[model samples]
Target: MKFLLLSILISVAAAKISTIKVTGTVLCRKQKQPGLEVVLKESDSFTPDDKLSQTTTNKDGFFEISGQDDEWGSIEPYVYIFHHCRILKEGCRTRSRYDVPQPVINGVYEMSYIDLDIAQSGETYEC
Candidate 1:
């Protein structure tokens, strides 16, 4: 009877789920800007994986990405962010490639409420 009870408890513990809430904004390195479209990504590592990601951002530069409960328990769940600007100039064209200048957030190992203010010019992106 003790063995059976122990097994059941272990099963229940393995099935536990938790939610992580990530929120942040994007702005210029020198200028404190707002209302920019920022792209945020969560990955098992720095590399992209089909089964490991969620992305959401708004014009105010705010973003949120919820991950699978087990994702945070892994080693260094990578987070990336980029600048998403709309091209408006007739003569000047925007760059085609998404700017993954660096890891806006990195090495996540715990449940967190994060806030990111990112800059591309070798400046630190905070959370």
Candidate 2:
């Protein structure tokens, strides 16, 4: 009976979910200007490995990422800021990757408001 109870407790503990709310903004490099269609990515740690969640910015250049720990139990959460530049023009069909440096996230599982300011050069082309 004790063993069965222990197993049940473990299962319950494993089911407990840790949630995080990620928010940020995108801006142009030259004047720290706000832009549209900014892309956001979540991964474990600040590195490229261990993807957790993803989201996009609104017209106000703001974005939010929310999910439970259970959703990413096998992976950690790291936030990546990016955007799609170079529309369907000559040699501009592909989207480019823009990596924000370390500490992109303010806090994990905390009610913190963070903002990301992306520069013009960070884009494949001007927005």
**TM-scores of all models?**
0.36, 0.41
Query: Residue 77 of candidate 1: its Cα lDDT?
Result: 32
Q: Model 1, 1-127: lDDT tens per residue?
A: 9999999888766664433334554444433324433333334355565233546445554555545434334322334543333323444322121222223333223312223322224433222
Record all residue pairs in model 1 with backbone atoms less than 3 Å apart, i.e. clashing: none
Candidate 2 lDDT at 5 equals 100
Candidate 1 worst ten-residue window by lDDT? 93-102
Which regions of candidate 1 fall more than 4 Å away from where they truly are? 1-18, 29-51, 69-75, 84-127
Q: How high is the lDDT of residue 116 in model 1?
A: 32
- Model 1 C-alpha RMSD to native: 9.9
Per-residue error (Å), model 2, residue 23: 1.0
RMSD of each: 9.9, 7.6
- TM-score, model 2 to reference: 0.41
Tens-digit per-residue lDDT, 55-79, candidate 2:
6666655666655454224324444
